[model samples]
Target: MSIERDHRRAAIVALLLTALLSLPLSGSVLAAGQATPATTAPSPTPDPAAEALDRAIAYLIEQQADDGGFVGFEGVSDPGTTTDAILALKAAGIRGVATESLISSAIGYLEDAAGEYASSGPGQAAKVTLAAVAAGKDPTQFAGIDLIALATAPVATPAAGTPAALVGPGVYGDDLYDHALVLLALAAAGEPAPAEAIDALRATQAE
Candidate 1:
C-alpha cells in the first residue's frame, strides 16, 4: 500500500511538471502562429503524465497480494493499506480492467476486517469510510457499520477547569489527524459534518 501511495505521489508530481512545461510551449506556439494552422500539428506526442500514471498502475498491480489486498510493511493485509491501494488504483483511472479484480479483492478484505476496524479508533473508521465512498460503496452500510457515525460520534466533555476540559466537547479526544480525516470522510460520503467539531478543530489550530 505504501508503495502504491508513493507511486501515486510520483504520478501527481509528473502531472504538475507536464503542466508547467506545457505553459511555456503554449505561449511560444501562439506567438509563432498568427495565422490558422494548415494542418492539425500531426497529433502531439504521448503525454508524460499519462506515461507516469501507467507506470504507477503497473507497479500497484504487481504489488497486489493473492487475496486481493496490498500487503503493508507488516506483511499483513489490513483495511488501511487495502484502502490506500484501492484509492491509488482509482486515481490512476484503472477501473474495469484486471485492476478492477484487485480492487474487488481489497474491498472483500475490508469487509471481512470490519469487525476489527470498528473497535480500532475514529481515524481508522474515517479512512475506511473515505475509501468506501471513493469506490462508490455506501459508507453507512460498509462492513455492517455506519462508519460516518462511528467517526463523528461526540465525546463527553468534563466540567470547566478539569484536565479533560482542555480538549473541549465534540472533539472525540482524538488528535488533529482524526478530526481532519473525519471531516474528509464526511465530505466524501456526502454527509453533513458537525459544526461544533469543525469549530473545535479550528480552535486547536489557533493553539
Candidate 2:
C-alpha cells in the first residue's frame, strides 16, 4: 500500500510539472516579470552636438595606429603622445572598435610604452597615464607626482604641425606634425574647447 501511495504522489508531481510547462508563457510575459518597473515617456529628438560628437569619435577610431597605440607625428614613435590620443578619444566617450583584435593590439602597445618615457615634462607622462587609465588599462603601473601636475594644468591647445616641435630640436621635428595631432586629440577627448575653437568647428558644419 505504501509503494502504491508513493507511485500516486510521483504521478501527481509529474502532472503538475507538465501542466506548468504547457501553460501559455509568452516572451512578453517573461520580460514583464523580469523587468524592473519604470515609467515610460515620449522620446525626444536627437541633438546635433551629440551626433557631431559621435562622428568625431568615429573619425578617431579610424585614426588608430597600426600597432594599437596613437601616433602623434606621422613618423615619430612616441608612446606618451599615443596615450594622450587614446585618452582624448575616451574623454569624448568613444568606445568599441570595428575589430576586437585591433583594440587588443592597441591596448598591448599602451601597456608596454606607458611610464617608459618622460619627454615633455613630468606632466606629459601624467597626461599619457590618464589616457591609459581612461582606456580601461591599469593606471597604477605608471604613477608619479609629475603625472598629476600635468593633468591639472590648463589643457594645452594644439596648433597645426606642433607635434614635431614638442619633440624638441634635433629630434626630427618636421614630420611628426604634433600640433595637428594635439588638436585632434583634444577634439577626440571632447575637452570643452576655447570659444574660438568651438566657433571654427561649428562653422565647418552646414544646416
Candidate 3:
C-alpha cells in the first residue's frame, strides 16, 4: 500500500521510535568521583518525556488486576484493552523479569478469554493477533488458538434482505476497517491474505 520509494525510511523511523522509547524510569546519579553508597536515592530521568513515560507506565501497572489483565472503563479485565496494553508496553521497549511476567499474565488472560473475544470478529482477532506478534508470541499457536486463521476467516452471509451480490467471499468482517485490520494482522504474522480477501478489499475503494 505504500508508495514511498525509500523503504529504508521506515526502518529509520522505527529505530528512532525505539531509541525514543528506551527510557529508564530512574537512574543512579552518584556524586562526582564519589564511591557507591550503601543505598541510593531514586533519581528521576532528566528528560521530561522520559519522566512522563515513567509516570504513565506506573499508572498502567497500577491498573492491572490480580489476573494480570488491565481494566478498561468497566473496571474489569477486558481482552481488547489488555491486548492494547500489551502492544503499548512492548512499544515502550520496557524490559525486565517483572514486566515480562506481567506480559505473560496479560497473554494468559488473553488466552483465557480469546474464545469469547476473537472467536468471531475479525477486527478483534486481528487486534489480538497483532498483540501476540508484538509480544513475541506465536500468533498461530497462541492460547492454543490460531489467531491468524481466525482473523482471515470469512464472514457469515448477509441478512436475508440484503442483496446477494453484496456479500463477498473474501469478506471477513462487517466493514472495511475490519478487513484492513485483518490484512495488517496477516502481514504482521507473515501470512498471505487470501486473494479473494485482497480483491474484496480493493473492491471497497472509491475513486
Return the TM-score for each candidate structure: 0.68, 0.39, 0.66
lDDT of 2 by residue, 173-207 (tens): 12233223334434434443345433443443457
Name the 10 consecutive residues with the lowest summed lDDT in model 1.
157-166
Which candidate has the highest lDDT of all? 3
**In candidate 3, what are the lDDT values of residues 63-167, reduced to their tens digit?**
889998899999999988999998878766653224676787888888899878998688899999998998888999988889888887877755454333336
- Against the true structure, candidate 3 reaches a TM-score of 0.66
Residue 31 of model 1, lDDT score:
44
> Each prediction's Cα lDDT score?
0.73, 0.51, 0.79
lDDT of 1 by residue, 108-145 (tens): 87888865775577778888887788678999998788
Better of 2 and 3 by lDDT: 3
Reference-based lDDT, residue 20, model 1: 60
Which scores better on lDDT, 1 or 2? 1
Total backbone collisions for each predicted model? 0, 8, 0
Candidate 3 regions off by >4 Å? 1-46, 94-98, 158-167, 195-207
Evaluated at residue 206, the lDDT of candidate 3 is 71
